[model samples]
Target: MNRSENTATSAAPAKITDSGQFKRSLGTWSTLALGVGAMVGFGWVTLVGGWINDAGTLGAASAMLAGGVMMAVVAFVYSEMVAAMPKAGGEHNYILRAMGPRWSFIGSWGITGGYATVVAFEAVALPTALEYVIPLDHLHLWTVSDSDVFLSWALVGAVTAVIITIINIVGVKIAGSFQMFVVLFLFLIGFLQIFGSLNAGEVSMMEPLFSNGWAGFFTVLVVVPFMFVGFDVIPQTAEEVNLPPKKTGRIAFISVIIAAAWYIMIILTVSSALTPEQQANSSLPAADAMATLFSSEFFGNLMVAAGVAGIVTSWNSLQMGASRLMYSLAQGGMLPAWLGKLHPKFGTPVNALLVLGAVATIAPFFGHKALGWIVDAGSPMIVIAYFLVSISFVILRIREPKMNRPLRVGGRGNFGVIVGATAVAITAFLITLYVPGMPAGLSIEPWIIFGVWWLVGAVFFVGIPGGVKPGPNAEEELMEKVYARYPHRRP
Candidate 1:
C-alpha cells in the first residue's frame, strides 16, 4: 500500500510531546524484559508441585510445550497485527480496523480483564511468596472460602501495589527499568535451578512421568495459555518501544520462546531434584527442589525471594498493560474519556493506572483463596481476546491484502492466509477447553465471575453510539458521540 493508503488505515505516527500519547523511551532490552518478566512470574515457584501432581514432570513439560506452540501461533498473529498497526491498545486497534468497533470493544475488554486479573493475582501472589521466606504474623481477620485473611499479610501486598503503581505513574521508563532489574533475579533463579539439576539431579526421581495419563495432561494443558499470558504486553506498549516495528514484533515472538524454555527447564529441574513423594509433600516444590539440590535452606529462601521479584515484575508489566488497554478503549470512546487522559508530565495513562491499581490494592484483602478463581476466570477471557485477534488477522489478510505488515508471518500470498486460519482454528480449539464438561473447565465461582464480567461489557457495548466506522476519524466520531452523551465533560 502507498503512504496515503496506509495513513488512511492506520493512526498517524505518535509524537513525543503529543497530549495523551505515550513517551517513546523503551529500548530493546527493556521491551524484551517487559515481555519476559510478565511471562516468568511466581507461578513456577508456587504452582510447580500442583503441576507435578496433576501430570507428572514429563507430562507437565509436554503440556507446557504444546501450549507454548499454541501461544506462539497467537503471538505470530499479534506480531503481524502490531507491526501493521503498532498502536497503544494491541488487540483493540487491530480488531477495530479489521472487524470494526463493537468487536474491538469485545476483544479489548477480554484482554483488559485478563491483564487486570493478573495484576490482582500478583498482588495476592507477592504476599504468598514472602510468607515462605519470613512468616507474617497473622492478625485474625475474617475467613473467605476457608482461607484466612490476615491484616498483616494483606498489608504487604497492598503496600507493594501502591509502590508499583507509583513506579508506573512516574513513567514507563521507570517501570521498564524496575521490570528489567527484577527480571535479572528471575533469570538468576532459573540459572540456579538449571545448574543444581545438572550437578545433583536424579533421573529416577522422574519415574512415572505420565502420572494420571491423558486426563492429568489435559488438566495441565488447559492452564498453559494463562502461564504464558504476559508476552502480549509488548504490543500494548508498542507505542513506547524505541525499536523498529519489525524488531518489536520479533521481540514479542522471542519472549514466548524464552518463556517456553523457562517453564520446561523448571519442570525438568524440579522433577529431577525431588522424588514424587517429596514433591507431593512440599508446599513449594521448585524452591524445595533447589534447596535439596544445593543442600541448604538459604538457597530455598533465595528461591522465594526470586519469586517475590517475579511477582513484582508481573505486577508492574500487567498494570502497565492494563492501563494502556483501558486508555485505548477510552480513547476510542468505548469507555469513559477520563481513562484516556495521560499524566501531564509523565505522559502515562494516569486515570487508567489508578483505577487498576485500586483494584489490585483491594484484591489482597480477599486473601489467597480468591487467586485460583481469578486465574481461572481470566484464562478464558485471555483466550477470547486471542481468538478474536486471530479472526481479525484472517479478516485483515483477506480484506486488506496490500496492507503493510513489517513482520509478515508466512511472507506473502495464500500462505499467510493459511497461517492465520491455523491460528484461528487452534485458538478456537483452546477456547472449548473451558466448557463445563471439558477436562479444563472452570469451577462454579470462576464461571460466575466470568459471566458477570462479560455481562458488564455488554452494557458498555450497547451504550456506545452506533455507526462509528473504523478508520482515521473513528476516534473523533466516537468522541463526539461521547461528548453528546455527557455534555458537561466536553471542553
Candidate 2:
C-alpha cells in the first residue's frame, strides 16, 4: 500500500505497446454457450457406454452426481476469482495476484496445456464422428499405431481446424456467435432425446447400480473434472464478456450445473432404454438407445449428428480460451514476445491462435481412437490448475482481504477458509485418481504426453522477467522489463 512498495513491486502501465486488447463483444448468451458447449463435447456420445459398462448405469449416474458436486465447488473458486479480477487470462491473473509470478506460470501453464490437448482431440474426434455417419476413408495416408489415416478423414479435421482458427483470429465475437448457434442445436436435440424416452424408459433396466463397488464409482467420478472443464471458459473469456462481473460468475456456475445435468440425463436415458447386456455390447449405445426409443435409425444417427455439433463447439471454445492464456503469458513476458501479439485490425491473439491451430491440424494423422493419450494427459493438468486456483483463493483472502469479490463464495468471517479448504480437499482427491495405485490410474502413454507438455511450459516458466509482483500493475511492470530486455521489440 505504501508508495515505495508500489514503486518496488511494479511500474505504471506503459502505453498500448502491443497490437491492442480483446474487444468486449461476447454477451451473456454467447458466454453461457461457450461454457456449456465446451463441456458437452463428443465425450457423451463415445464415452457414456464405457462409463455405464465400468460403473454400471446407476454407478455412472452416482459418479456424475458426486463428481459434479466436486467440480461445482471448484467453479465457486473460479467464479469468485473472475469476479474479483475480470481479466483476459482467468487463472493466470488470479494465481499471479495471490501467489506471485512463479506459481502463476505453473497454474496457467497446466491449464493452457489442458485446453490445448482438447483442441487437438476434437480435431481427431470430428473426423471420427464423420466416419460414423459415412465411411469416408477413401485414400489411405500411411499408418500410425495400427490406425490408418485416410485422405478424406485427415482433410476434414485439418481443414476444419484451419477454418476455426481463422474465425477466432478474425474476432472473438464471430467465434462466440458460431458457438451460440451450434450449442443451441446441441441442447435442443439433447432435450428431445431425454423427453422422448420418458414413456419408454424402463426402471428395471437400471439394476446393479454399483459395479465393482467403490472402484467402479471412482472410475466415473475421476473423469468429471475433465468433462466439466468448460465452465472455466467463462473466466478465460471474462474480459470479452459484455455483462456485469457478477453475471459472468453466475452464468459460469449455472453452466456447470447444466452440463452436469445433461451428462446425467444422457446416462439415465441410455441405460433405461437398453438392457445391461445391450449397454455392454453396443459400441454406439446412446444412438442405439435413441433408435430403440423412437423405433427409427434416423433418430439414432441424429443423436450422433448432434454430437458432431458438440465437437465443433468444444473445439472452437477451447481454442478461444487457450489462446488467451498464451497471449497472457506472452503479455507478461513469459513466452516469446510475439505470441501475445494482437491483430491490429481484429484485436485478437493472432500469433498464439496460429500456434495452437497448427498442432491441432496434425491431430488427424494419428486417427481418433489413438487420441485417448491426449485426453488422459490433459485431465490431470486441468485438475492441477483447479487445485492451484483454490489455493490462490485462500491466499488472496488472507493477503488482500479487502480485494473486491463480486461473487463471494461463503458467508461471514470463515467463508474464504471454508470454501478454499473444501476445494483443496476435493481436487486433491481427484488428482489421486490419475496417480499410480489409484482406482483409475492413468497409463504410461498419457504420463509421457503430460511430461512433454510441461517441459515446454518449464522453458517459459524460467524465462519470466524478475521482480514481477502480483497486483494491479503486474502486466505493466512485466512489459517494462520485456521492452528493456529486448530493445528491438516494438509494441
Candidate 3:
C-alpha cells in the first residue's frame, strides 16, 4: 500500500482564518435534503422512464430493487466509515489513511470523474425537458443545425452549469437551502401522485410482474447503483457541519429510507397506470403515465418543473462536493497550492468550482444519449472507490484501535464492522460486474471509457511533479485529532 499525502501544515485549520460569516450552519435535515436533491431528480423521474422503455416495466423494477439492496449495504459500510472519519474528501481521505497516498490519488479522480459525468447527464436532460414543456419554434433564429433540439440542449446545458457554479461558489448555506426546498417539493409531488392516482385512477393489474428475464433484471441492477452514488455528497460536507458525526449518520440513513419509499411508490403507480405499449413508446413516460390520471398539460408541466429543479439541485450539490474534495487534496499537497485558497468574501472554494464547471459544461454538445453513456462509463470507478472504503473500515479498526470514534459502530469488538464492511464492498463490486454491456443506442463503450478514465488518473497521480508525497505520521496526526475531540469511553 502507498502512503497518504498529509504534509501541508498550516498554523491552524483554514476555517479559523476566514471571517466565517458565510460558513453554513446546516444540520441533519439540510444534509438529507442535499442528498435527496442530488439523487431523486432525473433518475427517479425521467430516467426511470427511459430504463423502463429499454427493459420492460417489470424488468426495470426488479433491477431497481436489486440495485437498492446493493446500495443499502454499501450505505451501511460508508455510514460506519463516515461516522469514524467525519471529514472532507470522503473516500479520498479514507483510502489514503488505510491503503496509502497512491491509491488515494486514484480515489480522488474517481470521485471527481463521477461528479463530472453526473453534470453531463443533468446538462443533456435539462434541455430535452424544456422542449417537452415549451416548444422552441419561435426561437428558431438561435438554432444552428438541422437538429434544432440538439443545439438547444447544448446551450441549455452550458447555461445551467454557469448558474449552478455561481450557486456553489456562493457557499453551502444558500445551496443547501435551495436543495431543501426542491427536494421537499419533489417529495410532496410524489406523495400527491400516489394519493391522487389511488383515488380516481383505475389501477390496472400488472399481470406477470416479473416479465423481464433474469438477465434483464441483472442488467438493470448495474445501472441502478448510479442513482445511489449522489447520496455520498451528504457525508463529504461533514467538515462544514455544525455536528459532523450526529448529522452525517442521522441524515444519511434517514434520507436513504425516504428516497427508497418514494421510489417504490413511483414505480408502482407509474407502472400500474400505463400499459406496456405506452410505457415503451413515449420518451417522457412519467408525464404520459400521469396524464391518464390527470390532465395532459398539467402532468407535463409538473414533470418539466420537477425535472428542471432536480437538475439544478443535482448540479449545484455535485459542484460543491467536487470542489471540497479538491480543496482537501490541495491542502494535502496532492495538487497545485492555489487551489487550496478559499474565496476571500464567500469563504467557498471558488477556483475548484470553476474548474469543475468548465469540464461539465462542455460534455453536452455530444447530445443526451452520449451524456448518458458518459455517466454509465464513469459509474464503475465510483463503485470501486466505495469498495475500497469498505475495506478501509476493517483495516483502520485494527491499525488504529485506540483512535477515538465520536460515532462508533456497535457490536462485539470490531467483528461487526468488519463483516458489514466486507459485505458492502463485495456486493457493490459484484453488481457492477453483473450489469451486461451497454445497450446499442448509447455512444461510448462502457469498458473502454472506464479503462481510459482510470488509466489517465493513475498516470496523473503518480507521474506529475507534485504527485501526492506521503507525510510521516499521517495516521498519527489524524488519530490525535480524533482522540482529542472524542476520548474513548470505557464500557
Residue 264 lDDT (model 3):
64
Which one wins on lDDT?
Answer: 1
Best by TM-score: 1
**What is the model-wide C-alpha lDDT for candidate 2?**
0.84
Write model 3 residue lDDT over 1-491, tens digit each, in one string: 22222222311233212223236567666788887777776766665555555455666766676667667666766676666566666776777767766677677777777777787778777777788777534434233233343555577778878878888787777778888888877766676677657865554544346554775565566565567667788767777766657458666656566666666666667776776677667777666666766766687578667767777777777778888777766654456645656788777778888888887688666655556667877776676667777777777666665544545565438665766666556656654472565332223376567778877776656643322333324534543433343343100
Estimated TM-score for each candidate: 0.95, 0.94, 0.84
lDDT of the structure predicted as candidate 1: 0.86
Better of 1 and 3 by TM-score: 1
**Residue 142 deviation, candidate 1, in Å?**
1.6
Better of 2 and 3 by lDDT: 2
Full ranking by lDDT? 1, 2, 3
Residue clash pairs of candidate 3: 2-100, 3-101, 4-101
Clashing pairs in 1: none
Candidate 2: which pairs clash? 17-491
Off by over 4 Å in 1: 1-3, 13-19, 470-491
Local error of candidate 3 at 418, Å?
Answer: 4.3
**lDDT tens readout by residue for model 1, 183-225:** 9878887898899999999898887788899888888888777
